[model samples]
Target: MAKIKEKLGRWLRVAIGGPMGIIAWGISGASAMAIVVWGLQTVALPLLMLKTASWGIWGLGVFRESRAKRENPPPKV
Candidate 1:
Protein backbone atom coordinates (compact mmCIF):
# COMPACT_ATOMS: atom_id res chain seq x y z
CA MET A 1 0.00 0.00 0.00
CA ALA A 2 1.92 2.99 1.30
CA LYS A 3 5.28 1.17 1.00
CA ILE A 4 4.53 0.18 -2.59
CA LYS A 5 3.63 3.78 -3.46
CA GLU A 6 6.83 5.08 -1.89
CA LYS A 7 8.91 2.60 -3.83
CA LEU A 8 7.15 3.48 -7.05
CA GLY A 9 7.81 7.19 -6.49
CA ARG A 10 11.51 6.57 -5.93
CA TRP A 11 11.76 4.40 -9.03
CA LEU A 12 10.01 7.03 -11.14
CA ARG A 13 12.40 9.73 -10.00
CA VAL A 14 15.39 7.55 -10.84
CA ALA A 15 14.02 6.70 -14.27
CA ILE A 16 13.52 10.33 -15.23
CA GLY A 17 16.54 11.83 -13.51
CA GLY A 18 19.16 9.36 -14.69
CA PRO A 19 19.06 10.12 -18.39
CA MET A 20 18.70 13.86 -17.77
CA GLY A 21 21.82 13.89 -15.66
CA ILE A 22 23.72 11.89 -18.28
CA ILE A 23 22.64 14.27 -21.06
CA ALA A 24 23.71 17.36 -19.12
CA TRP A 25 27.09 15.86 -18.32
CA GLY A 26 27.61 14.80 -21.94
CA ILE A 27 26.77 18.27 -23.26
CA SER A 28 29.13 19.99 -20.87
CA GLY A 29 31.95 17.56 -21.66
CA ALA A 30 31.47 18.05 -25.40
CA SER A 31 31.52 21.81 -25.02
CA ALA A 32 34.77 21.68 -23.09
CA MET A 33 36.37 19.37 -25.64
CA ALA A 34 35.41 21.68 -28.48
CA ILE A 35 36.91 24.70 -26.73
CA VAL A 36 40.15 22.85 -26.01
CA VAL A 37 40.47 21.65 -29.59
CA TRP A 38 39.76 25.10 -31.01
CA GLY A 39 42.32 26.70 -28.72
CA LEU A 40 45.00 24.16 -29.58
CA GLN A 41 44.44 24.54 -33.30
CA THR A 42 44.42 28.33 -33.22
CA VAL A 43 47.31 28.99 -30.88
CA ALA A 44 49.44 26.06 -29.81
CA LEU A 45 49.88 24.00 -32.98
CA PRO A 46 51.49 26.67 -35.13
CA LEU A 47 53.82 27.70 -32.35
CA LEU A 48 54.81 24.08 -31.86
CA MET A 49 55.53 23.62 -35.55
CA LEU A 50 57.65 26.74 -35.61
CA LYS A 51 59.58 25.60 -32.57
CA THR A 52 60.16 22.19 -34.17
CA ALA A 53 61.44 23.74 -37.38
CA SER A 54 63.85 25.95 -35.47
CA TRP A 55 65.18 22.97 -33.52
CA GLY A 56 65.66 21.01 -36.76
CA ILE A 57 67.67 23.86 -38.25
CA TRP A 58 69.77 24.11 -35.11
CA GLY A 59 70.42 20.35 -35.26
CA LEU A 60 71.60 20.62 -38.86
CA GLY A 61 74.06 23.37 -37.93
CA VAL A 62 75.42 21.26 -35.07
CA PHE A 63 75.82 18.24 -37.34
CA ARG A 64 77.71 20.25 -39.95
CA GLU A 65 80.11 21.63 -37.36
CA SER A 66 80.71 18.15 -35.91
CA ARG A 67 81.43 16.77 -39.39
CA ALA A 68 83.92 19.55 -40.06
CA LYS A 69 85.73 18.89 -36.76
CA ARG A 70 85.92 15.18 -37.50
CA GLU A 71 87.31 15.81 -40.96
CA ASN A 72 90.09 18.16 -39.72
CA PRO A 73 91.47 17.25 -36.31
CA PRO A 74 94.07 19.46 -34.57
CA PRO A 75 97.75 18.88 -35.50
CA LYS A 76 99.34 16.02 -33.47
CA VAL A 77 102.48 16.79 -31.38
Candidate 2:
Protein backbone atom coordinates (compact mmCIF):
# COMPACT_ATOMS: atom_id res chain seq x y z
CA MET A 1 0.00 0.00 0.00
CA ALA A 2 2.75 2.39 0.96
CA LYS A 3 4.66 1.49 -2.14
CA ILE A 4 1.61 2.23 -4.20
CA LYS A 5 1.27 5.63 -2.58
CA GLU A 6 4.88 6.38 -3.14
CA LYS A 7 4.49 5.43 -6.75
CA LEU A 8 1.39 7.56 -7.07
CA GLY A 9 3.10 10.51 -5.45
CA ARG A 10 6.11 10.07 -7.65
CA TRP A 11 3.99 9.83 -10.76
CA LEU A 12 1.90 12.85 -9.92
CA ARG A 13 4.98 14.78 -9.03
CA VAL A 14 6.58 13.93 -12.30
CA ALA A 15 3.62 13.86 -14.67
CA ILE A 16 1.67 16.80 -13.35
CA GLY A 17 4.59 18.62 -11.76
CA GLY A 18 7.63 18.19 -13.94
CA PRO A 19 7.74 19.39 -17.52
CA MET A 20 4.75 21.57 -16.82
CA GLY A 21 6.57 24.60 -18.09
CA ILE A 22 7.45 22.93 -21.32
CA ILE A 23 3.90 21.80 -21.76
CA ALA A 24 2.61 25.23 -20.93
CA TRP A 25 5.03 26.80 -23.34
CA GLY A 26 4.05 24.39 -26.01
CA ILE A 27 0.39 25.02 -25.39
CA SER A 28 0.78 28.75 -25.59
CA GLY A 29 2.94 28.60 -28.66
CA ALA A 30 0.65 26.14 -30.30
CA SER A 31 -2.35 28.26 -29.45
CA ALA A 32 -0.69 31.30 -30.89
CA MET A 33 0.22 29.45 -34.03
CA ALA A 34 -3.27 28.08 -34.27
CA ILE A 35 -4.85 31.50 -33.85
CA VAL A 36 -2.46 33.11 -36.30
CA VAL A 37 -2.64 30.36 -38.87
CA TRP A 38 -5.70 28.17 -38.80
CA GLY A 39 -4.25 25.58 -41.15
CA LEU A 40 -0.86 24.84 -39.56
CA GLN A 41 -1.29 21.56 -37.85
CA THR A 42 2.34 20.46 -38.09
CA VAL A 43 3.72 22.89 -35.51
CA ALA A 44 0.90 22.42 -33.03
CA LEU A 45 0.84 18.72 -33.54
CA PRO A 46 4.49 18.30 -32.52
CA LEU A 47 4.00 20.27 -29.34
CA LEU A 48 0.98 18.19 -28.40
CA MET A 49 2.95 15.08 -29.22
CA LEU A 50 5.75 16.23 -26.97
CA LYS A 51 3.35 16.85 -24.12
CA THR A 52 1.87 13.40 -24.54
CA ALA A 53 5.29 11.74 -24.63
CA SER A 54 6.58 13.54 -21.55
CA TRP A 55 3.52 12.50 -19.58
CA GLY A 56 3.87 8.98 -20.86
CA ILE A 57 7.45 8.85 -19.65
CA TRP A 58 6.47 10.13 -16.24
CA GLY A 59 3.56 7.71 -15.93
CA LEU A 60 5.65 4.82 -17.13
CA GLY A 61 8.25 5.54 -14.50
CA VAL A 62 5.69 5.67 -11.72
CA PHE A 63 3.85 2.57 -12.93
CA ARG A 64 7.10 0.67 -13.11
CA GLU A 65 7.77 1.36 -9.44
CA SER A 66 4.89 -0.87 -8.35
CA ARG A 67 5.93 -3.63 -10.67
CA ALA A 68 9.42 -3.58 -9.26
CA LYS A 69 8.17 -4.57 -5.82
CA ARG A 70 5.57 -6.98 -7.11
CA GLU A 71 8.05 -8.87 -9.24
CA ASN A 72 10.51 -9.17 -6.34
CA PRO A 73 8.31 -9.61 -3.33
CA PRO A 74 10.22 -10.12 -0.10
CA PRO A 75 10.71 -13.55 1.33
CA LYS A 76 7.97 -14.88 3.62
CA VAL A 77 8.49 -16.74 6.90
Candidate 3:
Protein backbone atom coordinates (compact mmCIF):
# COMPACT_ATOMS: atom_id res chain seq x y z
CA MET A 1 0.00 0.00 0.00
CA ALA A 2 2.78 2.40 0.82
CA LYS A 3 4.53 1.69 -2.43
CA ILE A 4 1.29 2.08 -4.33
CA LYS A 5 0.62 5.40 -2.65
CA GLU A 6 4.15 6.58 -3.42
CA LYS A 7 3.80 5.66 -7.07
CA LEU A 8 0.41 7.31 -7.31
CA GLY A 9 1.77 10.47 -5.75
CA ARG A 10 4.62 10.60 -8.26
CA TRP A 11 2.28 9.99 -11.16
CA LEU A 12 -0.08 12.71 -10.03
CA ARG A 13 2.77 15.14 -9.60
CA VAL A 14 4.04 14.43 -13.12
CA ALA A 15 0.57 14.66 -14.61
CA ILE A 16 0.00 18.09 -13.12
CA GLY A 17 3.54 19.36 -13.54
CA GLY A 18 3.93 18.45 -17.20
CA PRO A 19 1.18 20.70 -18.45
CA MET A 20 2.21 23.52 -16.11
CA GLY A 21 5.75 23.39 -17.42
CA ILE A 22 4.55 23.38 -21.01
CA ILE A 23 2.26 26.32 -20.35
CA ALA A 24 5.07 28.28 -18.79
CA TRP A 25 7.35 27.50 -21.71
CA GLY A 26 4.67 28.48 -24.18
CA ILE A 27 4.09 31.78 -22.39
CA SER A 28 7.79 32.59 -22.49
CA GLY A 29 8.07 31.62 -26.13
CA ALA A 30 5.08 33.74 -27.09
CA SER A 31 6.43 36.70 -25.18
CA ALA A 32 9.75 36.39 -26.95
CA MET A 33 8.06 36.09 -30.34
CA ALA A 34 5.89 39.10 -29.69
CA ILE A 35 8.89 41.20 -28.75
CA VAL A 36 11.11 40.00 -31.56
CA VAL A 37 8.58 39.87 -34.36
CA TRP A 38 6.98 43.23 -33.59
CA GLY A 39 3.53 41.69 -34.11
CA LEU A 40 1.69 38.54 -32.95
CA GLN A 41 -0.49 37.97 -35.99
CA THR A 42 1.72 35.37 -37.67
CA VAL A 43 2.26 33.16 -34.67
CA ALA A 44 -1.00 33.92 -32.90
CA LEU A 45 -2.92 30.84 -33.95
CA PRO A 46 -0.09 28.44 -33.22
CA LEU A 47 0.56 29.98 -29.85
CA LEU A 48 -3.13 29.84 -29.06
CA MET A 49 -3.22 26.19 -29.99
CA LEU A 50 -0.22 25.42 -27.81
CA LYS A 51 -1.81 27.13 -24.83
CA THR A 52 -5.08 25.29 -25.50
CA ALA A 53 -3.23 21.99 -25.52
CA SER A 54 -1.70 22.82 -22.16
CA TRP A 55 -5.17 23.44 -20.77
CA GLY A 56 -6.36 20.13 -22.14
CA ILE A 57 -3.43 18.36 -20.51
CA TRP A 58 -4.25 20.04 -17.21
CA GLY A 59 -7.90 19.02 -17.52
CA LEU A 60 -6.83 15.43 -18.07
CA GLY A 61 -4.81 15.58 -14.85
CA VAL A 62 -7.79 16.97 -12.99
CA PHE A 63 -10.02 14.26 -14.37
CA ARG A 64 -7.55 11.59 -13.34
CA GLU A 65 -7.32 13.00 -9.82
CA SER A 66 -11.07 13.10 -9.42
CA ARG A 67 -11.43 9.59 -10.70
CA ALA A 68 -8.74 8.36 -8.33
CA LYS A 69 -10.38 10.03 -5.36
CA ARG A 70 -13.75 8.57 -6.32
CA GLU A 71 -12.23 5.13 -6.55
CA ASN A 72 -10.10 5.26 -3.40
CA PRO A 73 -11.67 7.76 -1.02
CA PRO A 74 -9.59 8.90 1.98
CA PRO A 75 -9.50 6.89 5.19
CA LYS A 76 -11.48 8.09 8.19
CA VAL A 77 -9.54 9.87 10.91
Candidate 4:
Protein backbone atom coordinates (compact mmCIF):
# COMPACT_ATOMS: atom_id res chain seq x y z
CA MET A 1 0.00 0.00 0.00
CA ALA A 2 1.05 3.59 -0.59
CA LYS A 3 0.67 4.55 3.05
CA ILE A 4 2.72 1.61 4.23
CA LYS A 5 5.52 2.38 1.74
CA GLU A 6 5.62 6.05 2.80
CA LYS A 7 5.86 5.11 6.47
CA LEU A 8 8.59 2.61 5.79
CA GLY A 9 10.59 5.11 3.74
CA ARG A 10 10.39 7.73 6.46
CA TRP A 11 11.47 5.28 9.11
CA LEU A 12 14.43 4.16 7.04
CA ARG A 13 15.55 7.72 6.37
CA VAL A 14 15.49 8.59 10.03
CA ALA A 15 17.25 5.39 11.05
CA ILE A 16 20.12 5.92 8.60
CA GLY A 17 20.37 9.73 8.63
CA GLY A 18 20.50 10.13 12.39
CA PRO A 19 23.51 7.94 12.98
CA MET A 20 25.27 9.13 9.79
CA GLY A 21 24.94 12.77 10.85
CA ILE A 22 26.39 12.03 14.27
CA ILE A 23 29.30 10.15 12.75
CA ALA A 24 30.04 12.99 10.34
CA TRP A 25 30.02 15.52 13.17
CA GLY A 26 32.38 13.38 15.26
CA ILE A 27 34.84 12.97 12.38
CA SER A 28 34.89 16.71 11.75
CA GLY A 29 35.54 17.44 15.43
CA ALA A 30 38.38 14.94 15.64
CA SER A 31 40.05 16.31 12.49
CA ALA A 32 39.80 19.85 13.88
CA MET A 33 41.46 18.78 17.14
CA ALA A 34 44.29 17.05 15.29
CA ILE A 35 44.95 20.11 13.13
CA VAL A 36 45.04 22.39 16.17
CA VAL A 37 47.48 20.14 17.96
CA TRP A 38 49.74 19.92 14.93
CA GLY A 39 49.74 23.69 14.49
CA LEU A 40 50.68 24.33 18.11
CA GLN A 41 53.55 21.89 17.97
CA THR A 42 54.83 23.36 14.73
CA VAL A 43 55.04 26.84 16.22
CA ALA A 44 56.03 26.00 19.79
CA LEU A 45 58.72 23.42 19.15
CA PRO A 46 60.99 25.80 17.22
CA LEU A 47 60.69 28.50 19.87
CA LEU A 48 61.59 26.05 22.62
CA MET A 49 64.64 24.82 20.70
CA LEU A 50 65.82 28.37 20.02
CA LYS A 51 65.53 29.31 23.68
CA THR A 52 67.51 26.26 24.76
CA ALA A 53 70.24 26.95 22.21
CA SER A 54 70.56 30.58 23.36
CA TRP A 55 70.94 29.45 26.95
CA GLY A 56 73.63 26.99 25.97
CA ILE A 57 75.58 29.62 23.99
CA TRP A 58 75.35 32.07 26.85
CA GLY A 59 76.65 29.49 29.31
CA LEU A 60 79.57 28.67 27.04
CA GLY A 61 80.48 32.36 26.75
CA VAL A 62 80.48 32.74 30.50
CA PHE A 63 82.66 29.70 30.99
CA ARG A 64 85.17 30.90 28.43
CA GLU A 65 85.36 34.38 30.03
CA SER A 66 86.02 32.90 33.46
CA ARG A 67 88.74 30.64 32.12
CA ALA A 68 90.42 33.51 30.30
CA LYS A 69 90.45 35.68 33.42
CA ARG A 70 92.00 32.86 35.47
CA GLU A 71 94.73 32.20 32.92
CA ASN A 72 95.72 35.88 32.56
CA PRO A 73 95.70 37.59 35.95
CA PRO A 74 95.58 41.43 36.21
CA PRO A 75 98.87 43.15 36.95
CA LYS A 76 99.33 44.06 40.64
CA VAL A 77 100.53 47.48 41.82
Candidate 2: worst 10 consecutive residues by lDDT? 13-22
lDDT of 1 by residue, 23-73 (tens): 544544554565587875565655565555544544554555455556865
Pairs in steric clash, model 4: none
Candidate lDDT (C-alpha), each: 0.53, 0.58, 0.64, 0.53
Best by lDDT: 3
How many times do residue backbones clash in model 1?
Answer: 0
lDDT of 4 by residue, 20-68 (tens): 4345445445545655777756656554554455445445545554555
lDDT, residue 73, model 1: 59
Q: Which parts of model 4 are misplaced by more than 4 Å?
A: 1-42
Better of 2 and 4 by lDDT: 2
lDDT of 3 by residue, 1-77 (tens): 98689769856655664445456556656656665786677667776776677666566656666666668866754
After best superposition, candidate 3 residue 42: deviation in angstroms? 3.3
Question: What TM-score does candidate 1 get on C-alpha atoms?
Answer: 0.41
Candidate 3 regions exceeding 4 Å error are 1-39
Show pairs that collide, candidate 3.
Answer: none
Residue 37, model 1: lDDT of: 76
